[model samples]
Target: MKNARPLPSYLVQRYHGWKATTHAENKAWYRRLAEEGQRPRAMIISCCDSRIHVTSIFGADEGEFFIHRNIAGLVPPYAPDGDHHGTSAALEYAVTVLKVANLLVVGHSNCGGIRGCHDMCAGLAPQLEEKTSFIGRWMDLLRPSYERQAGIADETERLRAMEKEAVLVSIENLMTFPFVQAAVESESLTLHGLWNDIGEGVVECYDPDSARFLPV
Candidate 1:
């Protein structure tokens, strides 16, 4: 019995149930989306953290949002020669092709990439250099913020500040894309900065009025 083939019972059952219900209730909707392609209303630039799910957090259904996830949700400034521009490419597709009305940069608390960048920049992780990893390169985007915030006495405060600064930087980088800039200037699209603190299940939006992340 132990050697007998095991089927993915839970997943298979759940998928079958979902498929039946969705096909019954949303067959037309699904067909229309498939034929016409997705016309998502918003584009979310977020971290690859498994806990930070944009769809679940926003209560959005399929085809509602175009999402781009990267390390620490960092968006590199427009560079002509940067070969690894996955985030930029996704942004272009969302803005130019999908024509999303809103672009959101969602940063989260307890971000591992942000913490790694902070530690590496502050010389707290000297052993990290031995490993030739993409994380080191990806976190390079936050180097400037790390340098500026290095003097903060409290590690916790410094990490928080870096996280916020990283979001602001990504927003600025988003403008570096010509399509994004044109969309914003033409009033066809709006940019937003959001922070999700998972531990407390608290979400904060960057309030331009006070330039602070306030609970939503």
Candidate 2:
């Protein structure tokens, strides 16, 4: 018996439509990308949520932005570990090799990873064990934020605060890398924080002047 779920009919149909669209543009653009190489002007770090597509959200085309997707869009502080550093490796490639001029950390509302962190911290989920899953380990990166907000009594406010705080934490971690820090100090690279409200179809940007998130 097959345990795999069948593909949705709509998805199958969409694939054919995507093929036709891509085929028309692939010859010209794909070859150019291969020959000229990717010179994307920005690097975006976003969540792996299917609903939060960075390319579609930003109306970006292929080879336009170097994107790295991870659980909760979290960026851990720089640490030289032998284990795979998926997000950090992508950052190094984009900044050091591709030399992208901008880096944007896009955080979205109602992120499952963020929700998981909140749930786990509230004792609504199981404790981490030796066999802790990948998500559990990834959410560990947000422990500091969770700890800081532990005293909050309101669940809704806590989640919202955690979501935004997580983005700030990632930006802080980005600076831990020597290359990223040097670029920022030299004004060669700029960092941006964006919040996407998936339900409302609204985008909020971090306003440094107001020190708050304002709709954009």
Candidate 3:
């Protein structure tokens, strides 16, 4: 523990400022949230892109959402083989424990993780193919989606298609969990897919009826 690092001064200062301002202003609400515990109605699985601010975009309150962010916001195929599965574990907790009414797999435009997966599959990023590469292995979950979009001829359109596919793929994989499947079947849970364009400030929701992403 000797080499453990302390938080940066600016971040610490910001925390202090928030503690004195936002925290003080919303003291009762914060205290109630702490004492009563969180009961978020929605669970959001989103990319860990700094530009994609899920909370800010949705104007969600502190305890309104149970959010999980990873490289591509991916959900691996359910395998109860007693292995470490962080994303799947979180998904299980959300669907079973939290019992969120809505589960959203939110993908965003210009995802570096998706691009990396595309490049790796195309033999452009050799580093990602290494067995020791964590990102590479994690992105393997998204490789199927990349292959699904292989028919697209234009690079830009294909990239966009793959970005949207990330959400679609996660939704498909999420259903592999028995609890999630049960919840949806009983109308206890509703699954949603969303893709955001950060630059254009546009959001699209996947319509299962039309089988296309429509502006929302």
What is the clash count for each candidate, in the order shown? 0, 0, 0
lDDT of 1 by residue, 1-216 (tens): 779886789988988999989777999889999999999999999999999988988799989999999889989988979576788899989999889999999999999999999888878776554467588877888899988998999989999999988999999998998889999999999999999998898888898899899999
**Off by more than 4 A, model 2:** 1-16, 127-131
Of 1 and 3, which scores higher on lDDT?
Answer: 3
- Number of the top lDDT candidate: 3
Residues 44-157, model 3: lDDT tens digits: 999999998889998998999999999988888889999898888888888888899999999989999989999999899999999999999999987877788888999779
**TM-score ranking from best candidate downward:** 3, 1, 2
Per-model TM-score versus the true fold: 0.89, 0.89, 0.97
What local lDDT score does residue 54 receive in model 1, on the 0 to 100 scale? 84
Q: Scored by Cα lDDT, where does model 3 land? A: 0.91
CA lDDT of each prediction against the hidden true structure: 0.89, 0.88, 0.91
**Where does candidate 2 have its weakest 10-residue lDDT segment?**
123-132
Best TM-score among the predictions, by candidate number: 3
Which candidate, 2 or 3, would have the higher lDDT against the true structure? 3
Ranking by lDDT: 3, 1, 2
What are the per-residue Cα lDDT tens digits for candidate 2 across 133-194?
A: 77887898898898898888898888888888889899999999999999999998999988
Colliding pairs, model 3? none
Error of 3 at 104 (Å): 0.6
